[model samples]
Every structure is written in C-alpha cells, then in structure tokens.
Target: MRPRILIVDDEPQIHRFLAPALTAAGYDPLRADDGASGLKGIAVWSPDAVVLDLGLPDMDGKAVLEQARAFYDGPIIILSARDREIEKIDSLDRGANDYVEKPFGVGELLARLRVALRQRQRFPGGETVIRAGGVEIDLERRLVRRDGEIVKVSPREYDLLSRLAQGHGKVLTHKELLVSVWGPAHVHDTQYLRVFIGQLRQKLETDPAHPKLILTEAGVGYRFYSP
Candidate 1:
C-alpha cells in the first residue's frame, strides 16, 4: 500500500506543490485547509504521517498537535512560516516529530518524511519490543510499563525514550537525538533535549535527580542503559 501523507495547511500553493511531490515520491497525498478539518482527517483517513502548518484559520496548529497526540502516534512534521527558535521548540516539545520552516525545499521535506516512515517501519510484524530493567516498551502497541505498572508519557516523550532505547547503550549524540526526534532544523536546540530528558527521568527513573536508566554523556546526548 502506498503510504498516505496528510498535508494540513491553509495555503493552496502548498497543496499544489506538495500533492504532486508526494505523489511522485510514491505516497498518497491527503489535504486539509484548517485545523478542525485536519484533525477530522487524522481520525478518518489515519494517514501514515502528517505535515502540519502552525498558522491555521480556525485554530493554532499547536492545539491541533496536542489533540492529535492524544490518539495519533504516527510522525507529524510541522510546516510553519514561523521561524522563531521558540516556536519550533514549542512544537517539538508539544509532540511534533519534526519541524520545517516556510520556503523549505521539497527535497528536504521528502527526506525528512522518508526518515519518519523508516522509523515507523523499524517494528515489523510485532517484532520490536524492548525490555530493560523493570521497563517494557511495546513498540507496536505504543505501551510503556515499568515494574508491571503502566507509565504514561506524552507523544514526544515516548519518541525520545524509544529512540534512546533503540540505541541499546550506544551513545546518541545531542545532534543525533535533536535531529532524529525534533528534525534537522533543531539540531542545535539542546534546551529541548534537557526539558524532555528531565521529564523522562521523572517518569522512568526511580530518582529523577540521580538518574540511572537514562545516563547522560555530559557533553554528548544520552544512552538507555538499564542493565
């Protein structure tokens, strides 16, 4: 099946540009001009990935992102005109998997989309589950449990934790985690990592202050070493 990609932007030109590009890249393109309709499309079509624009006529894109995170676990790439550092960080922190500024190259967008899809395909036929220490992560089911108790996490938090877990003790650099979880444009946004890492430690670590599960590499990123 051709992967379905939904483009949620108010600009007609964006649709015109992306629909064809996505089709050329072997994806079924879906479109929505406003946040409400975009959320509806997510529920109805259940696209493999989403390209969201922050500037919506009816609502801010962040609101839509929050609602989508409630149910949708697929990759969501924010396509926004706002190029401010805080805006990108806010979106990534709010559960967006990636962010692209306006006037982005189609090639870059396609590459990012492919990365997202590739990450999704890592768990094939229920073969991708990670168990470390007292934590069990069911990738296919998107469930995380520690010591037989369910550990709830936001979408971004889950993504971050999964990335680290997948590394399997291999140190993932700051740039690597930022780009993989927050997109290439945010490779320099280390603060986003700090905030999310703190959140993850609070939830996953027995003691957030002296973390043991997610070991920090000081200048580098982090490693998930529960054993």
Candidate 2:
C-alpha cells in the first residue's frame, strides 16, 4: 500500500510543488492549511509521515509538533525557513524526526522520508543486496553486478561505490566520502576520491562521459540516483 503522507504547510506554493512529487514517489499526499486543521487531520487520518512547516496561521509550528508528538508517533520532518541552530534544536527536541530548511530540493526531502520510514518500520531486505540504477550491490557478498553478470572492480572502487549507493539520493560531501572509505586521515584527499569516482562511473554507468547513476554536485560532492 502507498503510504499516506500529510503535508501541513500554509503555503500554496509548497503544496503545489510537493503534492505531485509525493505522488510520483508513491505516497498519497494530503494537506492542511493551518495548525487547527493540521492537528485535526493528524487525529482523524493518522498519516504514515508528515511534512510540517514551522509557520502557521493559528499557532507556532512548535505547538503543533508538541501536541502531535503526544499522540502521533509517525515521522515528522519539519520544513521551515528558520535555519538558526537553536530553532532546529528546539523543533527536534519537540519531537520532529528531522528538520529541512526551506528552499530545499524535493529529491533530498524524499530521500530523508525514505530513511525515516525505514528506521521506523525496519523494512526488510535490500540491506544485504542494495539495488539501484540498474545494478545490484550485494553488501554481504561484496559483489557488484549488472544484467546478472558480475562487474569486476577494485576493492577501493567497490568500497566507494557501496558507500555512495548506501546513501542513495543524498549528496555526500567529499570530506565525508574520504573519511568513510579511506579513513579520517584521508579527509583532505579530494583528488583521490575523484579518481575512484571516475573509475566507478566507468564500470557502472552506460556512458562514463555522461553518468546518470552517479551525479556530480559540483563543489559539494556526489549523489547516487536511486531511480
């Protein structure tokens, strides 16, 4: 069954942008314009996950979050323009599962929702064999395959590929990748990371010159496209 996701934001623009994206991602999206109706929706419908905004016409978003947490245990990802550390800390402390600053990418939000749902439900499989982008990554077996045929990759290359795949759809920083695969000492080794990334694309992508699976985030890092 498709998970019913409740979007509690007063902004018409946000609703217009997210509703279709949520549908495309296989979620039945519903909405509420104000805090009163949002709380009512939560009590009546009991959605699987919530995309909540910090601003509301009736009450502060923290109030809604606090009240909702008292009864609803589902994931609540706070979406707001407020980026202050204290505000984020407060929302999280009030039982928000995650906080996304406004003007965010839909893909990032979807990926975060996927992670939150998995953590809450403990969805089985794929942990052992992570599959995405027309390939299978058997983590337990430490193997990569496409079209049922094994693809040979160096240990370092495989490690990098698996790291990116595990983080599917999220942009990972160069420092993060360097530290995860090559250890903390190699955090500054950006060139080394780039070399391994190119190698992985060569082996996995249909066209290494124009990779779709592993995408470069320019100055940031890379994001592995799941589908």
Candidate 3:
C-alpha cells in the first residue's frame, strides 16, 4: 500500500503546491488548513507521516504536537515560516522529527520523509547489528553492549540508541529520531528524547557531560561520534 501523509498548514498555497508533488512521489496526501482542523484530520486519516506548520490560526504548532502525542504514533516533519535557530531548537525540543523552513523544495521534503519513514520501519522490525565507538548494537537481538559487556536499556531506549548508532555518525534531527523510535504520534515529545539520551549517555559514555560518543549539534541534531 502507498504511504499516506498529512499536510497541516494554514496556507492554501502550501497545500496546492506540495500535495500534487506528493502524489507524484507515490504517496497519499491529506490536507488541513489550521491546527484544530489538522488534529481532526489526523484523527480521521491516521496518516503514516505528517508535515506540520508551527504557526497556525487557532493554535500554535507545539500544542498540536502535544495533542498528537496523546493520540497518535506517527512521523511529524515541521514545515514552517519560523527559521530562527531558537525556534528550531524549541520545535525540536517540543517533539518534531524534522523541521523545514518555508519555500523549501518539494523534492527535499520528500527525501526527508523517505528517511523518516524508512527509519520508522527499521524500529518495529529487525535491523542489522551496528558497531561504533566500542558500542555494539545487535538490532535484531535488541541488545546493546559496551566493550562486550551487556548494557541495560528499556525497549524505547533501545530503539532510540539503535537508531542513532545505525545513523553511522550522520547527524539525526530530533524529530527524525523521535518519530522513528516513538512513531509519528510521539514526534513532538522532545523531552522523552532528551531524557533517554541522558540515560543512554550514562550507560555508554565514559563521561556523560563531556561526551565523546553521542555528540550534540546545537540547533540541528545528535550524532553518534564514530572514530
């Protein structure tokens, strides 16, 4: 079956331009013009992913994210006019899987969606073992080890760490990790990521505060430092 996507934006033109492109890209697109409407659509459509806008008429994007988390498990990519570093950080902190500023190329958006969804599929199913920085993630086994010693992790925590390790040192945006590990519904729950990252660092890093393995990218994302 073709993947379904929800596009939640207040602007009609945003939908007009991207919906057709999404169709061409081999996905179904559902449109919502405002936050309240978007939530309603999400409840009814149950899309595989969502392209969300931060600035909505009746509600801010953060609240919508909160609501979505309460009910849904899917990927959410923020498409918004807000481009400031602080805004991006806040959005990531709030639980978006990825963020794209307005006037973005449709192709780029599609590629990001591909990455998010692919990673999501890797979570519920099995994945190959990943080794980096003395940590071995046996994804298929759902086990993590440091220097051959088994490392304890909850199911969600294992999924989160495995995704980062699987990224192979590439930076993973907050939303990408959130959605991939927690699903589209949990994409906006950034605190969950932060808290669990801290827990993982405590177990994996020689020094949590001065981490040499799980590196932060300030306004962008996190990377599993390899080599």
Candidate 4:
C-alpha cells in the first residue's frame, strides 16, 4: 500500500496543492484544518507521515507536534510559515523529522516526505504483496501489475484498492472506506466511492460488468478476493 500522509494545515490552498501532489506521487492525503483535528487525525488515523503547520487556529502547531510525538512514532514534517532558525531547531528537537517553510515548492516537499518515509523505514521487512483475481499489488513498492505489466492508476484508485487489498477477505464498510480515502469530511459521500469503485473495476477487472477481484457486499461495502 502507498503511504498515507496527513496534512495538518488550515489553509485550503495548502490542501489543494499538497493533496493532489501527494496522491500523484502514490500517497494517500488526509487533512485536518486545525490543531485539535490535526492531533485527532494523527491519533485516530495513524498516518504514515505528517505535514504540519505551526500556526493553527485552535493551538500552536508545536503543541500538536509535541503531543503527537508522545505516542505517534511516524515521521512529522513541519510545514509552516515560520522560517526562523530557532523555530526549526526547536521543532527538530521536539521530534519533528524535518521542517519546511511555508510557500514551499511542491516538488521539494514531496522529496522531503520521501526522505522521511525512507528514514523511518515505513515498510520494514518482508515484501507486502497482494494478489486478487488477475491484479498483483506490491504494497512496499507502490506498484500494481496485471499480466506482469504495471497498470497506471490514479492516486485515489491506488488508495482505495490498497485499503481493500490490505483488508484482503474482510468486507470494508462504506463509512470505513470513505473515511480512509476521502477523510472524515467525506464520510457520507458514498457516491464518490461508487464512481471510484466502478472505475477500479474497469481497470482491474477483465470484465467490469461482472467483477471478481473487487466484490460488493450489497448495501455494505467492498472486499478484495482472498485467493
């Protein structure tokens, strides 16, 4: 599965830029607009990495970072407007994996995130590979192959497929899949799932009209074939 990155900035522009970039780079993007929600996202979601901003409406970003470090061992990259040397030093000392000043380039941010994930060894040991129907998912490598050839999938498609594939045989509820891929804000947006799931079937299923790899559990949700 691709890494899930939680972006804890209140700015809509930041989310717009980062979320797409993160997804295009094969990472799931989740958002929390303020410090409290940010903390909650980190605690509840357990994102693979974080891009946090220092100026939060509810509380200081430093507080969120500190509180997060208390239990969340994953990488946190501070993405704030505060570019002061002291701020960087303090944040790093307080368990931030790295710091990026605001108005930063999307490319640089992605590179930093990549480095943080590498350093943390997000995928530690054995290869995480999943096979269902004709599709082969390599979680650690972030590649989906069909008939021994890589299949290009959108970031959202990858995220949804990854979640379902990770769960293997278990049926994931609509709320669960919606929340994980589109964040809590879109928990009730079941229509989004329907469209994406159909798209996934088209790409992964030899016959989208009658899917075998990704199956629906009637009014419930979806499941990835176990064998």
Per-prediction TM-score: 0.61, 0.56, 0.65, 0.54
Kindly list the per-residue Cα lDDT of model 1 for residues 18-123, writing each as its tens digit. Answer: 9999999999999999999999999999999999999999999999999999999888999998987667667766777677889899999998788677766663
**CA shift of 124, model 2, Å:** 4.6
- Model 1: ten consecutive residues of lowest lDDT: 118-127
**Which residue runs of candidate 4 sit more than 4 Å off their true CA positions?**
122-227
Off-target runs (Cα >4 Å) in candidate 1 are: 124-163, 166-227
Clashing pairs in 2: none
Residue 112 CA error for candidate 4 (Å)?
A: 0.6
Runs off by more than 4 Å, candidate 3: 125-136, 139-218, 223-227
Residue-level lDDT for 10 in candidate 4:
87
Best by TM-score: 3
For each of the candidates, give the backbone clash count.
0, 0, 14, 1
Poorest 10 consecutive residues of model 2 by lDDT? 118-127
Model 1 CA RMSD to the hidden true structure, in angstroms = 10.7
Q: State the lDDT of candidate 4 residue by residue for 31-86, as single tens digits.
A: 99999999999989999989999999999999999999889988788898987766
Model 3's alpha-carbon lDDT is 0.83
Q: Which TM-score value belongs to model 1?
A: 0.61
RMSD of candidate 2 to the truth, in angstroms, is 7.0
